[model samples]
Target: MSRRDFIYTLSATGAALSLGACSADGGSAIRFGYIADYNGASLLAIADKQGLWKKHDLTVEPKVFVNGPVQIQALGTGNLDYGYIGPGALWQPASGKATIVAINTLAYADRVIARPGINSMRDLKGKKVGVPEGTSGEMVLNLALQQAGMTMKDISKVAMDAPTIVSAFASGQIDGAGIWYPLIDTIKEKVPKMKEVASTEDMHDHIFPTVFVSAAKGKAERDRKVMKVLQEANDWRAAHPKESIALTAKLLKADEAKVAADAAHVKTMTTAELVAKTKDGTVDKWLDGMSDVFVRTGQLKKSPDPSTFYAGDLYTKAAAR
Candidate 1:
């Protein structure tokens, strides 16, 4: 498709979304950025519907962005204040363009699928394994190999994009494919016999948490009151999974069935849970885990410390209220 990673990984695909407004101010008005995707903006939609914004007397000018980079860019330029972001775009924060404020959803859709006989990650050893070289598929494949006590050197890595990898798999050119949903779904429809051998869920010690990000370079000052209200929304999302799905679809302006399918791959948690995780150091560990993946994959020269981008203290301050 466009310049992107695999779909259902939440960084994939586009939707017909053109909603929101803007008003400049502090106490009453806030310029919020969000993508037209469930994993990114679902909680905000749910919270808004529950009157959390009004409870806090907020007039949020909710802006829809295409992807993380675009949202980060807007934040950097002071065009927006806070928004949702995916794991792949954490580099934006690491570079001082935005700051990680809170956790959004934990997504576990990255997969490595293989022919029916390939029952485990080890089964793909010495086989032609195709993946989009720089996508989450590649990361999941690397993690899968490590879990299987193997590495890329042990397999034939056929480096290609999502579509090409799917083509190769469908044509039997590769014994397995490292990819995510929608694309993985496409491969399944074309090659129904293929089954999942490994997924992000298998990497038990690691996480793929989408986050709520705010200004790093932008001029807007942080507001503890606003953060408190957003946490209220998060609380609602954790308690109402099914209703949240319906509102998230409307926020994304996407097909409800597609949204439902994608929603299954995510874990929604309350603000108290997120605060507890941060206090217990799990949030820092998760950020560092993703950082390590980026470094190992050549996306970063070295891993940046979580304190450089993560604002766990800030999250705590808000949640305490």
Candidate 2:
């Protein structure tokens, strides 16, 4: 079946199974899906390990996925009540299969790295560039190309996951890659000559927000409570940075120093700050920009209406609690 058809089927299946998806605690212990790439979802990992979810009267069943789009597909099929996803993989929102509830981390985590001798985006022409299709890596690469007066058509696109991309770059299978940390860090360590040609850090207006999303039936009052707990967890991290980094490194099975460095790339907001940002149109503006980038990259035929997918009211109500 076509991708769109598959997504439609998943949504229909989820709607049919919605009645049984919730648990006894008003759906507090909902199934959560996340990527294991050691990004902002580490906050969720911290919450799970630190008993923050339990503190908020919630139980969680954490599911790990290879990438955001796959996890989002599960979310559409009733396999997950909540998911932590990047904006580029949120095509489900355009189709009315899910709604973004809260922003987890906003930062400059995505990067485009070039193998030595190809130092600029313009030098990428005719070169093999690796990225996980339908993820933020691809989106960022497209933006980088646009900035250089080029497009995906200018390069030999290689679809691969971050770790595989690292291997490919090391083996000379691909000349460059657009990937996110801590995987980008891995590539840099493995290939000392790799040059970071572009990054979200250079695109200040183009923020990378790892957001929390829920299926239609998953957006219950209990789910809001869960988000509130996530806000509380962010507050805890801010107050206890050392402990948070140690715990995150343990959960990710990554180097403590690497985790600490990764932590610096992302900024988590408090409940009040989340509410204020969403209310002041900042979130909408960012979503609009994200949609444009997706469309420009041929990921979407046209941009979806930001209002349809963004549930700012969810964050507003969660913060009010």
Candidate 3:
């Protein structure tokens, strides 16, 4: 099935309700939210399938959402204890409603693809550019425009969800789009001429960190253990690369080679490394930059103090175990 079709199937079938059978030990259960994207949440799937959560005393019930905004809303309402989200989704709600506990991966996932004849970022001026408004797709586009000495006003902005943006791109409805995989990969397969003009790889410093977020109320002892075990799962993936790739590919129903290649682009950190980054101001610096982009995009009225949103103590404690 197509990426759009696959997402529709996930939504219509109530995929969240089928996150494996509930744990008989109700006290150990945790509601985990994640996007059904290959790049971001595949590790969570690997953990689930490999029984890592059980080892860590977490009976994780996976909740799948279509996009980051919806997942953030679930988190804000306390329906989810933990979720994976991009920096664009994290910054605004994280300022008050949620706390980011871990940076799961630094991924070169987002891409700016232009239709035929639009050769450069400058060529995108005066053309229609599609972006998923509230997610990292828009953030990356905004950053790219700023880097090109332009603004959103320089182009006609078309806001759509990632899948629809891919459809629009295929139909020649939008001149280009700022999107991530597997939509980008799907689009390229259908529209071979789609030119990739920019990506997160180009905006290295401005890139958004895909993170694990939780509401303040959910940060109990069990939730903290969940975070640590997630790091343990990441370490497991690194140590057992072949097995990791096989399981993730099977879960995502994607090709193992493609999954392996995509996985390579993501740098997963350990619990100790996470603590060090948090302490040395690296996380703060990245969030500060993202906050400025959020304000410029009108996603936030004012930038919140970037330091207030992190829960570094969780990782520090998790690492101790």
TM-scores of the models, in the order given: 0.72, 0.87, 0.89
lDDT by candidate, in order shown: 0.73, 0.72, 0.73
Best by TM-score: 3
Query: Model 3 residue 213 lDDT?
Result: 78
Superposed by TM-score, candidate 1 places the C-alpha of residue 117 at a distance from the truth, in angstroms, of 6.4
Please report the TM-score between candidate 3 and the true structure: 0.89
Cα RMSD (Å) between model 1 and the true structure? 5.1
- What candidate 1 gets wrong by more than 4 Å, as runs, is 1-20, 24-37, 51-83, 88-92, 95-97, 115-135, 149-176, 218-229, 253-258
Per-residue CA lDDT of model 1 for 1-321, tens digit only, reads 211222332322122221224223344356777755567677667666777766665567667664466677777788887887767666567666778877787878789999878898888889999976644677788878888889899999998766677778888999998777645766777778888999887778888888878887433234565677678877877788778888876655556776777778888888888899999999888888888877766677788878888877877987886
> Relative to the unseen true structure, what is the C-alpha lDDT of residue 61 in candidate 1, on a scale of 0 to 100?
66
Question: What's the true lDDT of residue 240 in model 3?
Answer: 76
- Candidate 1 displacement at residue 68 in angstroms: 4.7
Report the lDDT tens digits of candidate 3 across residue range 1-321: 455543443344334334445553566467777776654566676677667776765576677776777777887777887788876676655557777777777767777889989988899999999988778788778888888999989999998888888789989999999887766777887788889888888775675678887874555676577777778877776677778778766655666776666666676666567678888888777777778777777777788776578776767777777
